[model samples]
Target chain A: MRFRIRFAQQVVGFFILAALATLVVVLILMGLNQRWFDRGYSFYSRFQSADGLTPGMPIHLRGFEIGKVTSVDLNSNNRVNVVLQIYSEYYDKIKPNSVLELEQGTFGIGGGLNLLPGKNLLPPMEPDSFLPSTDTLLGKNLLAQGLVDQPANNDQMSAILAEVQTTLSGVNLLLNNVNSAIDGTSNNQLTGLLQGVNATLRSLDSVLTESAHGLVPNLSAITANLAKLSAQLQDPKGLIPKLLDPKGSLATILNDNNQLYNEVQSILDQVNQTLVQVRGLTQYLNQSTPQITGVIEDTRTTLKKADDVMTGLANNPLLKGGIPEKKPQNATFHDLRDEDF
Target chain B: MTERKPNLFERVGATTFDLFHNTFYAFGFFWNVLGETFRFRSRSRVSTQVLVMQILFTGVNALFIITLIAVSLGTVIIFYGNQITTLVSTNFVYTILITVITRELGPLLTAFIVMARSGVAIATEISSMVVTHEIEAYLAVGINPISYLVVPRFLGVTLSMVALNLYFNLSGLAASYLVAQFFHPIPANEYFGQLMTQLTPTAVASSVVKSLAFGFVISMVSTLNGFRAQQSTTEIPIIVIRAVGQGFALLIVVNILITLVFPR
Candidate 1:
């Protein structure tokens, strides 16, 4: 039993020693993983803003991370002064005239700082030296002089976002134009004014049907026929052929210039007078009813439908109802002077 | 006038006072033991031998069960905690593992186990010696029974408890990494790197302080209850039971107090 006790004490001793060993091993591993012993060379740069730039952000050279940011502060000039800690192993890449660029993240993704190396073939800068950033005036002059090797921007996400922004702006302008065009009150478009003319014509057509007993039964067909006649006259095979032939009636009339010219001038004068009267009539009708579906380019077809519907309501007295008298809502009178009378 | 029997309020008041008195006495005993621990090297080889035996019984004897329980707990926590906290962050399991096994559960569970195993045995042994006149024999020889008997067990139990808790944390954390393999398939470097990152200094300090406080509480409660034994042999079993119960209560209370006072 005593021998067993002695062996047990040995085991207990080993247990404690082993636990201590584990603790020491873990601490060492942690130190290595967290880079506790690595030497850092310091450099400073300035930026316009501190957005998306923070201490401990990885600084990439070309495409690989070679250092980290140490401190970020605002100088007296209201500019962001960022201090970088480049690892001693990569300190050779940090030559004089090197520049820094702060890349902002797109749509909440993280972005990193990029270091543009010097192109002067100079030696590495010493620690605690000043480095210029792309935002600084000196950095811009260095870039203009080709002293720094600024790589081509290969970020495709920013280009795609810019295209999306431009497309959204064009769509917004189109929507505003469309909104103002069809909003009715402020509209001064060709279709808007022509619609008011159509409304006036419709009222005149209604009144003509109601007053006339045996006039045109379908003004819509008359208007269509008139449009067709004008289109035919403009065709080469129609009026042109007749006028150009020497034996044609038009040619004969043209041969007798004085009488025919006098008659044609009188007809043109009558047509001009008729047009002016129609304009005055249209204006008078527009005052009574204030909307329009005018007999314009596309509305000509709409006016035909309007004439058909208008003729019915105008010619049929039984279908039209008379206006009824409106009764007063507040009929009670509590006036003492009127009651005494 | 006839004296009146104490009412329920007075009975409760007296019991509360007794409980507080016992608590104060136990703390005083802890202070005495701490003072004697410094001078324990001046004691005879018998006390040192007793200390070695105490360590052998408390720490080495309890290793197998502690390892088994730790591995089982670690495996369950990793398998479940990984799946649950994955909704928040993929690396959240490391924080959970460190918190449960190191900062909170590691010290707490080991203290409970040590109290259950060593505490009852210590109380029974000391009380039995008292009933058998062995304590009187030490006193008659001009030897302080405290330095010769109780001090060794006190130091032994406290040291064993702290060592056992550390061993528990090491075994439990290692087991969790192994169990995490079935789920995450992480490299050892990355696994331990992330775990070590989450295991901050505040957490390690919390675990150590709790372990020390609970070790003292368990040893003090058990030895105090043991010395309360009387001449009758029947008092041995009673004091031993009281020692186990008191040790458990004090361990839990001290664990809560340390956790509240310190940051984890």
Candidate 2:
């Protein structure tokens, strides 16, 4: 039993060692996969902002990750100075004029630095040399299009906070005003005016109701009668059309030349006879002119006496207490009574 | 004679003292085992036999359950991992698997299995030996029980944990691929290539380091609990329960500390 246990132990120990060996091999494989053995050359880039840039973030050429970010530092100028380590194999792809673009993933999921090559065919950039950044273009474009937020420095953030505080104060004031209005503590003139207008509107409503009840049907009936009359006038057998028709009586009278001449001659004869009678009557009036004037004078005298009698009757005490004692017409004179003195 | 009840302060002081005392004892035992592990030339035939026997008991015996749980865990991970393939790239999926299996679950689950199985067994065996006066017999024979028994078990449990964690990772990844074939059906080379690309040395090192630390903790805690047993046979079951519980707690705390210190 002891020997069997010993054999089993040896077998288990062998398996344990094997498992550990496999683990070490896996670690080595991972190191190799990460290019830990590869010789890389470092380059530097300066950006205005290192917003999404981080160490170990891959640097891509086209779509391939040819390098990685080694470090990011804020220089004394408040600019981001980034160090990039590119594999020696891809060193030829770097040019002195190559632009390093710090791009973020869509919806801000991931971000990376991309090397956009320039037109000049210069030799490979020296290790540790500085490369230009696309920060100016990218930052401005992203800020303008609202694709990315602006990096808020201490001063800008403070300014934004101040503005927010001011807005909050204004909102607080507005809320206070609204609360006062709701509680009826502030007697708003507009509210009183609105109430008055509401009362007027109620009166106007009653007036309009009366007018509608009284006038609407009558107006409708009048319009209906007008419409009937218009319909009758528009009928083919109407009087106006009948009168204007060539075969109608008025048209016949207009169309017959001899009859129209005879009618005009008879109308002229009647006017001449009437003028003769008017001349006779004028002669008669000239002969009786004196008598007519005397009769007009007599009639005026009789009218004056009748007016006096009517005035005396109106001034009788029984009628109006001596016509209420006519007001004096004199400028200064008045009868002085003992009580007035 | 009538026993007097301990006051609150006395009870607190006793608890505190026991905590510190047990912590120091476990640490001393760990140090001694570490020293023995390095003393290759001084190793005796009996110690070698004991070490081999421990390896057989802790590691070889636990493989079946470890493999079973690992494969099942892998299948479940891949089943859900494939669902997100449409939203994220397959490379990202591989990264998720590596982070979950290698970085977190692999070492932790292996430690749990070892603590549940071998940890309880070690405590019960040692406590029983103590109760039967076998420990006294070893001392009478001028044998250092710690170097003979505890050191071998320590080395055995720690080595077993590391090996089982490795096996678990391997079997999990393999099983995940098999399950993923039913959903995605990609070539094996392509799948493995993507996985390799996503795997990092830091991640692998973190996993191995975690496994090593957890193994050491589980073994030390279990052995320490075993030694706490008294002459009464009733203490054996209590010691075993304590060993399992304390070993689990120490494993989690140590795992968290290592992850924090070596974040991927």
Q: Can you give the TM-score per candidate against the true fold?
A: 0.54, 0.63
RMSD in angstroms, candidate 2? Answer: 30.5
Q: Which residue runs does candidate 2 get wrong by more than 4 Å?
A: A1-6, A95-97, A106-110, A119-123, A137-341, B88-90
Task: Please count the clashing residue pairs in each candidate, in the order shown.
Answer: 3, 0
Report the Cα lDDT for residue A36, model 1.
60
Model 2, A65-91: lDDT tens digits are: 788899999999999999999988899
Residue A175 lDDT in candidate 1: 72
The best candidate by TM-score is 2
* Fraction of native Cα-Cα interface contacts (under 8 Å, chains A and B) also present in model 2: 0.58
* Candidate 2 similarity to native, TM-score: 0.63
The residue pairs that clash in candidate 1, if any, are A195-A292, A196-A292, A198-A294
